[model samples]
Target: MFEILLALLAGIAAGALNAVGGGGTFVALPALVALGLTPVTANALSRIALVPGALAGAWVCRREIGPVGPTSMRELTAVSVVGGGVGAGLLLVLPASSFDAAAPWLLAFATVVLAFGRRVSQALSDRLGRSVALSSRALLTGQFFIAVYGGYFGGAVGVMMLALWGIGLGLDSAAGNPMRIAQLAAIFASATVLFLVASDALSAPLLLGAMLVGAVAGGYGGAHLARRLPAPLLRGVLLTTAVTTTVLYFLRG
Candidate 1:
């Protein structure tokens, strides 16, 4: 019971951090493992919780996301869905222990990006404001890869999506937020289905339920704050969280 509450609280904090900064799982993932889940189970369950939060974030940014046009959104979302499903399938079939052993290094890399992600995002938005300009192929390729990574492991996925959108999609923050949210949703949606269908009942139901509630709340909060706060400040917070989480993870090592 205490562990469930801890997970719920950790999720809420992560959601709040992600809502404002991005990558709250840096906080939640390790905590879940500490509470007794295997690393892969913790990572997979994190995706389950992420769905509602992504939806909440997208809903909050709906008006801003409108400028991207229905056609583009529909098309991009379809690609993301397919890519995400494939990635999730990969996770289901592969031995996560090998990946799990290497996860800390991946998290470390993600932490590096978290520090400068927003600044890089702003720069990409400004410099390339040049739209991949009807290059359907580039868009498809980049989005698919991002979706796969998003499904496989998500800590650094946002940074990756930013790069894909910035270069291939030539997107600005307004369009990017909703699109990214939708893409992330697809990623988790696929992973969640995979878990529901294949893996033995891996996570504790109580922990899953708590994370769901916390993620929903945190997602709403993060989305709302993304606009209210200055981008640089948000970036700074994200960077700090990434570094802190990395340090904590290493401490356990």
Candidate 2:
């Protein structure tokens, strides 16, 4: 009973951490494991626990949904949603060991994009500018790949989303919130349904209720904090998180 309560409180903190920087999973995940859940179960529980934070972040930044196209918003949102669901479904059949092993590499890849994301975004934007056509099918494909990675081991989905927008969508990674939030929306919805449905231990009533409250609180706090932080600091946070998560996962393995 006390453990469950602790998980809730800890989850909120993790959500805030995630919202602010990008490494809340490291915090919430370890806490869940220490509370006695298996890694896969912990992963599922963590997903359920963080949905509220993701949704809140997206809602707070609703106005920034995508490029100036009429259908851009629809495409990004739809891709994210479908990709998230597919990734979540993959979680049920895929071996956690495989995802866990690749976790460090994923972190490294996302972190590299984060570190140089601005330059990449600028260079790409200069070439394509704001007029480059966004390929929905390609974007959706990327989203699906990212979603699968996120579902299996979502250590740095934010960084990945930022890079995708910058590189793929020809958008300013640091400026707008809509595209990234939309991706998060997809991640949250799919993860929520997957974990809540597939993971036996995570399907508990008390846990889910607590997870819900904690996620919402943390997500709200995270978004507010993110909104206040400058780009330089946020990038620094991403760098630190990337390195820390990489080390932690490798050490754990």
Output the number of the TM-score-best candidate: 1
* Predicted structure 1, TM vs. truth: 0.88
CA RMSD of all predictions: 2.5, 3.1
TM-score per candidate, chains pooled: 0.88, 0.81
Q: Candidate 1 regions off by >4 Å?
A: 66-71, 118-134
Candidate 2 lDDT by residue in tens digits, 122-154 = 787777776765576666677677777676667
Expressed as tens digits, the lDDT of each residue in 157-205 for candidate 1 is: 7667766566545666545666666667767777788877775434488
Residue pairs in candidate 1 whose N, alpha carbon or C atoms collide under 3 angstroms: 19-222
For model 1, what is the alpha-carbon lDDT of residue 249?
78
lDDT value for model 2: 0.68
| Candidate 1 lDDT trough over 10 residues, lowest sum | 62-71
